[model samples]
Target: MRKIASAFLALLLATLLGTAANPNPGYARVISAGHVEGVLPDGSAYVMDVPTNWNGTVLLYSHGYVPDGASNPARNAPSEAVRTALLDAGYAQIGSAYPETGWVVEGAMPAQLGTLNEFQARFGVARRTIAWGTSMGGMITTGFAERHGRFFDGTIAMCGLEQGSVANWNNALDTLFAIRTLLAPGSTAPLVRLPDQATAIASAAELTAALDVAQTSPQGRARIALAAALRNTPAWTNPAQPEPDANDHDTAQRNQFGALRQFLQTGLTWRQEAEAHASGNMSWNTGVDYARMLANSAIRKQVEAHYRQSGLSLRDDLAALAAAPRITADPAAVAYMIRNISFTGGLTTPMMSIHTTGDPQVPVQTEQAYAEAVTDAGRSRLLRQAYVHRAGHCTFTAGEMLAAVRTLEHRISTGQWPDTGPLTLNRLAEEWDPAATHDYVTYSPGPYPRPFHLHR
Candidate 1:
């Protein structure tokens, strides 16, 4: 980093000398392994670490969604191992905890930038800066890259919901809607307009009880399959069990049930919080054609086979869904969600993303959807996506993530992408840490079942 102007240094000498009120004042070379922890101007707590052997590069990490109950100001990275590896590799790291949690993309985006500004003011600008995030952080990363590409040399997103906030809730509504209409027809499990957190919790528990009973009968299993398909949920919920065969409908239904047992409640609670943020319901199904949606779903085969196995007519379920009363979104609430964040694809920085092939929370198909958006924005060449053979959300080892980071760094250093085939990536990961098993694989995910994109 270039030296700060002498005049500017003199002006802040008193602060640097350390006043009684400000012991850890700014503008010093962080030569030794030291941590600078403080809250940003926006009240977001931030943490920064610089190694003795600085590599002239900084990694800006944006963490994933934390529910309100779990929100904290702890300054940390997504993973301890990854943070350690980055420091060991001589990369400075910085991140901030957003002021609010649970789908705070609007808040998170600025919080990250604020953290970066703090980093620049304390220490000089690094030669290179890389922005990376996971889950909702990934969404923030995508938007940040587009809006502030000059600030970063590259961007990396892992298991991210690149489809943005509006699409996320809309797709979730499809799954919850099907579950309510088909599984708990006589019961109350409002998919939207949740009165409060308690109501959402009760509804989720009620739906879960109905789900447990439905698992006993083939008829119920078939409907579960439909709901899962609508959300593009994978069939690999059990970490202990080996991955089921793609054509195995029985195992698929079982896995879907296992995931939804928790996901149903998760969706309800998250929607409740998100609705509270928007100040009204944001999901709707007024004009959606269930038959057409099921027909277009990537997991349609599983839904069809499960229905056939139960000796139930898939048409009947579709008809029932068609006849069910539809929900409409409040115009103001819809606007709030759209402004929460959306993508233009207008990617200026090189972006690398990795995902577990079977992530149930943020499905691999989101990668595909985001790729198309970038392609439409004429920025396809700036993006590269890879998948791990794991079976859960953000289940990547530190090695897997660094392998991707090295690949992007290579592109940054050489101005061209390296061979990112699964074989090549797996090799890179193994070299990073021979102890951690890497499962990079060549897989193509299908389109997201219910896509919602920004018109702009």
Candidate 2:
């Protein structure tokens, strides 16, 4: 009896060990999360976070621009939220701070893929790979899809800026000029006002001061007041609002001023060290240089010419002075942007792009240009679009988010691409309200209001 009992115990132990080794039949066990260093072909080191799971799908995530230098992708609240959501869905998440953030895609792609290779080696699983991102990440992913379409099974880009190339770049510069002209002080059709020029300058100064004060007093009322004050201004409204004109400038300006104020007050701030940590570059000199260059004469001539060609006049517009005309092609910068673009080839992967119709930071037309390009290239079958009818930056409702996730998962699991037939404006006014107006505004979709196109 004793011999028989010992044999039974040994068999049970072996069974338990086998179960531990194999765990879930359809999903890999949660392995670990750690930093992995990826080296680009150019020999630059990129640091990223890996959340291990064995679901047979590895996701490569690229982070957006870190203008203030914040580098840890894992630390961003939005990124953390998305990462958690994806991990819970049974994917191994690889988050990388790709090649010194500021829109440098050349070095970023290799570093991102290198990290993927490392994750694969560490886990020993030959899983399908997907690429995903928001804003700049979206841009980088699109760039990669355009060049390396075969690398990713699918891509999920949220509020990405897909406009590059000479034409798109020129359009972007024109929009910047318009914003400057509309927002500058002493302009009758100003997009926003701060009581006076001093106030405008003070608001920017106050933001820096509040950041300093908040470091010492995290919950200070002064910061709260500043935030509230900023929110009350007009410039803070949707950055994607229609351009200010003599007829609508007052209302738009008020809305924009309030919005800007609110953003500065409540937005996150990284002190000098924190910015340095995120950006990897310690100096704030790049931003300063960008600003100074905008003020230079040579650049102004290029900007003025571009504005004229776009059918916008610089004459008699105080806001025009804000235009940075000299923003020409920096070979290094363009090369970086191109690298990210080529890393993810376009229209080859199952992709769903959603953008707010009135996104200010990234113009809605940017997405349109991408979709048009895909269509023009005969790759429209692989892409679908959802447009939000709101005046916000990449803002989406919970329902929309869930819908997107479902569409993506369905494509990944069943190899069935979703249809693009249900495209419609996301918002509606009261039932009694008339049909939405279809004006010929910049970035508005439809035929021109008159014979000529409304150039941006």
Candidate 3:
């Protein structure tokens, strides 16, 4: 009897571990929380969790960028808190590690679709499915809505770069270019046409060091302010610290400096990676008007104040920018960025975007551009956007996320948008998880500094 029991136990383990997905990858297993882990046909690994009391729903998650060296690809989730909470709430969860990493949208979209297919094959299709993504994943989620909307019930894009890669990369390039032109002219940062990946990484670190030294001097701070304004980077950076006091020019400049380094350190080096993927330079500053950009900046006064304190000539600096040679985009690369993907605002699914108001990296302005896409496509009613009063990219509480998810779910179920105002959502979010502060606030972002798109 003991020998028979041991053999049965071994067979159960083999069935759980070996039969996770189609063809049974053999490494797949039944983990804690009744989760199944396996690999897909495209070499993308996948995992799905089903609660004891399944709610007939699945949340398909797409994750953000993972650097080349650090591509774990073990799990796909926006955050651990969201994953644990959603699974506990009886919603089935599934995600896939993309076949490649680092700004890999082309691979992400299909990998996600395959994961959903794998999920259906293994556990059977849920009654409803919602796709959610963060950062780059959010961008992928947007594309999914455009290309494959009928598959999911709805989508939630948190801190997404949904404004298309061409425009977004150009924006990042503008900031890094300004940093190079204004602070360290010809400092070997390799803004575009990066020689290699190692040089690209080194250049980013070099720029970070330069920003650090620049912050100590008034001249450096003023230039940084100008660059931030041109880049449309928000003056508030550190989430741990409160927003800098208005009229505190020094502190504000400090905040801008922090924003530049905090976000751009990684952003600066990404051009090389982007160029490799794009097949040429996709960013250009040839015709950008420096004076006009500064004039329109919300932080215009802040830049002027910094220059005045430094006893520097803002006009001269602007003149210098006007005279500086601009980077030109390769037509082929620009075509790749465009033809590869562009948001037509043709989201067939009811979509909701949640963003932090003070993100210097993926600015809140991205949502503005995406709104235009939706409006232009005549699908304005299908989209709703909400924001959190926080700094940093994708820095959202699980409660805030759940509230937005619930809001979107309610809209899908009822075919009507609930009170999406910040106050209502904040109150609702607080009701669910009081420990996590919910600061969904009424806010509208200004124009994105750079935009490039051609949808056919």
Instruction: Find the candidate with the highest TM-score and give its number.
Output: 1
Candidate 3 shows a clash count of 0
List TM-scores for all candidates, in order: 0.91, 0.54, 0.90
Off by over 4 Å in 2: 1-53, 71-78, 165-169, 176-250, 256-346, 389-391, 397-399, 413-415, 419-456
Local accuracy of candidate 1 as per-residue lDDT tens digits, 137-166: 888888877887877899998889888777
lDDT of 3: 0.79
Ranking by lDDT: 1, 3, 2
Winner of 1 and 3 under TM-score: 1
Specify the poorest-scoring 10-residue window by lDDT in model 2: 446-455
By the TM-score metric, which is better: model 1 or model 2?
1
Candidate 1 root-mean-square deviation in Å: 4.9
Model 1 score (lDDT):
0.82
Error of 2 at 381 (Å): 0.6
Q: After superposition, how far is residue 398 of candidate 3 from its true place, in Å?
A: 0.7
Ranking by TM-score: 1, 3, 2
| TM-score of structure candidate 2 | 0.54
Whichever of 2 and 3 has more TM-score, that candidate is 3
Off by over 4 Å in 1: 1-33
